[model samples]
Target: MSAVSRLWRRAPLWRLCVYGTVFFAGLAAFYPAAYLIRAIPSLGKLHPGALHGGTAPDASKPGPGPGGNGGPPGPGDGRISFLPLTQGLTRAVPFGGHVLPLPAGVWHPVLSAQTGPNGAMLTDVYVRTDRGVVSGMVVAMGTAQPIPDPNLLSVDSPCHDDRAYARGELPSGENVVSCWAIGATPVHDAPGTLNPVVAQAVDRLNALGYPIPPLFMTMRWMHLTTVPKKGVGLEQADVMLSPAAPGTIRLPVPIDQWDRGAIAGAPAAAHFVDRMRVWAQEWAPILERGHAGTLDPTTIPDSLTMDPAAPAVH
Candidate 1:
């Protein structure tokens, strides 16, 4: 007791107070320093690049700033655009009740004939009929030789019809004639009679010097019987006018090899025959005038009979 009391009495008050303050300050500083040391690994994980110099920039991450890759326009961008030439020159014609238009560069010319070994100028004709639209690629040639009027045919004369006379009423010799190799699809459901509108239209074409035959009585029918044989490939039909037969105008209407399916809705054979009469009449002037050159048969190369298996008449 004597020694402890003596030591306490000897200790200074200011020194004791200073020692307490220093101890508290040390405790406070130690806790903060330990916390900072423990937090180093976690902070490094948060900023990997800061710790590792090889770290790459991650574009997909929520960025410190905005950035992106430029991409192409998608399908929903907009509509397409187009351009065409010869805009107004295009026209549609009805054949066999179907509507067809000339090829891009084709033009319909006024009726004119050709001569020599060149034969007829072939061209495609379109007609709209009750059955549908039908097309005929026709090889037409004209002769300078004059022909007698169809109305002036003699009784019992084989050339009584326009077609007969046009084909050259007689066989023998080189008959200067215009021939048409017409390939067509049949018309179906056409009125039993011709449509007057179509008839008039054809008549107008004839008047305009287009080589449609006058044999067509109405839009639906014609009296010409030879057309079937000439254009449709009927051997026994008797419409073909032989170049060798005198006074026998050979109207060899050669039809191409057609699929029966194509003719399903075409006009009846009888109706077609009748229409041929009108066609013959319409073409009479062109044929007699030998204006076959007006036809551009090359436009329809595939319509011609090129196959040996095809019928001789077609």
Candidate 2:
């Protein structure tokens, strides 16, 4: 009835047998070859620690000698060796007229937008981790606006609206405000106006092969007054660590307010909150130095033989 049936009927018995064998073999080989082609590209972007089934070593921890665990690769390694997390981060990059510690690993630049007075700039860098969690930081320089104190927000507010907000003062007296939100305002949602910066940033990230989840939980820390004596305006940094979720959590009753402790205790948010806490403290001083114009990129050792020496934020 069909051409294949006609060929099968006319061919001699051995010819049919050989043709059938070749056809089945090629079919089997095609799938594996296709799978390999799809998988090979991701291998280059994988976290090195992922290969070993553990988290990458802390960036602050020094590696053995040259090109060791926490250090950048030496000359002999013919390929670009993957460093765990933010290790091998040896230089500060300029952003919005201030220098900031650049995140390593899969973290890449998303958007650097200037929508503030006098060309004040806001830069956001983000990455989708191997586990599908999204983590990143936003730095703003010479900005007139200050992060609102969460304590003053009304209880009816979705998040950062409770007295449970936490605050700490750095050794140099800069204020650090941290908060967590279970159901944050979605960056892009239907029936609402879309922010141009966020829209463009998402497009760029998608172009770079990173996918943004439809819904996510957010943990944020806002560092205030990093440039204590800036003549023009305030300099601030906001860091966010968010994990993707399949859908927004449903509540039995309307949420009147959110308590940080309660949110941190929730099973869905506990892990991300803990990681955010550790990262917030670790990044505070480095961000401070960068905003204060005290971190010099030139002093960072190429070999990463030792940590760079920068004055405490004043």
Compare the candidates by lDDT and give the number of the best one: 2
Task: Give residue 277's error in model 1 in angstroms.
Answer: 2.3
Off by over 4 Å in 1: 1-134, 140-267, 290-314
**What digit string (tens of lDDT, one per residue) describes model 1 on residues 1-314?**
79757666787785687688999765443322212323432222233322123121111111010000101111111111111111222233322222232322222322111111111111122232111111122211111122222321111122333322122231112322223221122222122122221222333444544333212211111112122222211000011111111122122232221222332343442334333444444433332222223443334333221211112221
Indicate the worst ten consecutive residues by lDDT in candidate 1: 63-72
Give the Cα error of residue 70 in candidate 1, in Å.
64
Model 1 compared with the native: what TM-score? Answer: 0.19
Off by over 4 Å in 2: 1-91, 122-166, 171-185, 188-196, 206-209, 215-232, 244-265, 296-314
lDDT tens per residue, model 2, 181-235: 2223244343132233334444555565554544333323233342234322334
lDDT of each structure? 0.24, 0.36
State the lDDT at 77 in candidate 1. 12
- Pairs in clash, predicted candidate 2: none
How far in Å is the alpha carbon of 302 misplaced in model 1? 30
